[model samples]
Target: MLQTDSMWRCVCALVLTFPAYSTAVSGVLNSPTNVQLTSTNMDLVLKWDPPAGAPRDLVYTTELILRKPLMDSKPGCVNTSALQCDLTHLVVSIYGRYTGRVKAQLGAQSSAWASSDDFLLDKQTSIGPPNVSLYSNGAKLEVSITDPVFVHSSLREIYYYATYNITYWKKDRMKELKHISGLQQNRVVLHSLDPSTEYCVQVQIIASTAQKPSTPSIVHCARTPSEKEPPWVAVVVALFILAGVLTLVVFVVRHWRSLSHFLCPKYAIPEHFKESLLAPPKSSLYLVMQTSQPVEEFSDQISVVMCSRTEEDGSKKPAEEKR
Candidate 1:
């Protein structure tokens, strides 16, 4: 009877070691994995390994609990079958230390919580490289840089870092190269550079804390135009153009008067002379005769008469001989 009891106990132990439904439920709540916070929008991302030990009849579900200064309040939670969650909408203040955790749930049972090593939530990353823009101001190459927005209000100032390659070359020969570095405001003013040389330039940025310098910007090149003028050259050019326009306007006004006289004859004539000129009578004729001859010899010759009569009256008048 004792031997039979021992055999039954052995059978029970074997049954507990490997349940029929246990194969479907298997996971472990590993340590908190990826932990990072974005500076701009205060977005938080947390990840972890899959959890272990779920009830044989239930599927394992993962939950994320994020809290500032450890698990103080009911941690903002999310339930998913995946291993990670983004906690972007958490309204935690950016003042104190922050900690996050993950837990696995299966039916009424939950695995151990895995928490992240505490880190300050209010930390701000260093600024990025300033956006460099290139331009020119008469015979000089100019650079303009715009600063990045600061996440931490403590950042008060930004400094520019720059380098350049300037060269003068001929057929199969090159000479006069230079590299320069300095700290200044957002604008770099280069003076007395070689006028006819080709130059390539790059710019970088550094913050007040003196972090690792940002990656240098792409190289830009400009050959200084020949040194022929000063800043006042633009004003001189404008004045010259204005003088030329004024002279042309005066010439145009004088020429326009002559053109008007030639095109319109009525108003173009002198008013005093026009009043003395008589209007001609319509359909009339005038005649004049001057001669030195014997009066009797020309007595029978027909003569033209100056008449101011209508055509009907002239046609009815008969011819009469002079005595």
Candidate 2:
């Protein structure tokens, strides 16, 4: 019975060992999928999606393949946990064609490398958009555009020359657009614009090495300044006003007495008129006596007569008479 128990235990051990060995020999990992290469402002990047059923702890490795005679892949992003890698520094030739590849790794097991589509460095790389600033000069508008930022190379270093494309229009008149293409100046002046009017503008770069023109900058708006009067005109007007004030002051100094006399008088009243107004009123006795009837006058002279007694009939009787 003890011999039979030992054989059964050996059989159970064999079964467990066989399954583990089979998994080790036959199991295969899935490679990374959907690899892509892209660049913006000369900054190249490699991106990929994790393999199906990939573990959360799986690491990744990346390589850059340059298409040429006897060329080999350059290894980077080795044993990395991130899904993306920056290969901006690995680009040796600005005009060369390139490709990117990546693989998923977990301990001793690793998937095959998945490749990306071919990328042309000179024609496929993207450039940054332009930046715009506006200023309102008197009777004109000034637009200023700046060069796009570069990652590993400058505009002059790659293309040797660059230009700008400007589009402008009156405010609220978007359909009537005006374009100024292939401008070489950063500070562009728009002349012959309407005065005291608002205008909107956008700018783009014409890079020779870029696949197309750089993205257009944000729209900027400003109003043209109004026309101003000349400085000499104001001076002339002020001089005229000062001259008139001086003339008026001189005239007043010369005719001050005449003006005062016309405005006020100093005549005096007679003394008789004052007495007549202030005297007390008299009675009307003289006026009534003078208004009586006139009496008759005698022509011959008469002698005086002395009498001691008068007649009784109201008649005078003379006692002695003298002629």
Candidate 3:
């Protein structure tokens, strides 16, 4: 009876220690409670820690499982002693939120999986930079671009802005050419410029997360011409006045010479007739008078004179005093 009782006591002690052994086993597989994922060329990685408070004799195994949400009832698992596991079988599809889980394993028992954080993947190829153009129209500079026909998003919102830099006569410079969002078209016009000045303009585009600008567009140049003067200009008017004055001076000098000739004439008469013409006429039918005084006394004077002579034929001589 004593031997039997001692055996029963030993069995009871062993049964009591079983719970402690299970608790220790739980601790070994509970180390890693948090899960993280990273991606590379063609693989996704699952990262976690070792079991919690485990003794050196306790061995742990990490298991990572991935699946398409709501589609795969059973998640594919990676069984390994390493803290990180590569996801080579996971496929990337249309962009969306993905679900995954990481679990801890010890011997034949496994702990509930620690849920993983959500991840987003963009697998579409970029459409590259849109085409750009810089040109000049009369006094204005024009900037133009082609809408991105091929891009990552079909309904993607697009925005655009541009800046122009000019270097003239050896000086550094910059100008904000444009800042436009959701334009209906790609063309813009700039006006108001100093005439005869040289200018340069730069153009850029935005689509999806705004593409990198084009290699600074080639330089474009234009020079405005000076306006023309009116017809029959002021200069011609000044010349006409100068010519009219010169013609008037020539006419006056020519008329002065002619008037002087008419006022005073000089002539010499024949010597014989000169005396007869100078002699006073004989008075008969008229009277003759000569005054060596001022003409003020002649206001009431009326002068009359006659010339008479006898010819060889006894007739009143025909008076002939020729000069």
Residue 306 lDDT in candidate 2 = 74
Model 2, CA-based lDDT: 0.85
The 0-to-1 C-alpha lDDT of every candidate, in the order given, reads: 0.53, 0.85, 0.51
Better of 1 and 3 by TM-score: 1
lDDT of 3 by residue, 112-210 (tens): 667667654333223333455656566665657554443223313322333333222201233523333444466766566554555554333333332
Q: What is the C-alpha lDDT profile of model 2 across 120-230, one tens digit per residue?
A: 876787777887999987788899888877886777678766889899999989999999998888999998898788999999888876778787899999998777778
Per-candidate RMSD, Å: 20.6, 32.2, 35.1
Question: Candidate 1 local accuracy as lDDT?
Answer: 0.53
What TM-score does prediction 2 earn?
0.63
Candidate 3: the clashing residue pairs are 31-51, 31-52, 287-304
Name the regions of candidate 2 deviating beyond 4 angstroms: 1-25, 68-70, 227-323
Q: Give TM-scores for every candidate, taking all chains together and pairing residue i with residue i.
A: 0.44, 0.63, 0.30
**Residue 33 error, candidate 3, Å:** 3.0
> CA lDDT of 305 in candidate 2?
72
Best by TM-score: 2
Candidate 3, residue 289: Cα displacement in angstroms equals 99
lDDT string for model 1 (1-323, tens) is: 99999999999988987653364355333333343333332245555655344333432233333355455533455456656665545535545455556766654445566676554433433345556666667777787766545443333422223232222222122344344454556677566767765666666654433434444566566676776877899999999999999999998798997877788656466776676565443433332223344456434656564435457656444455544
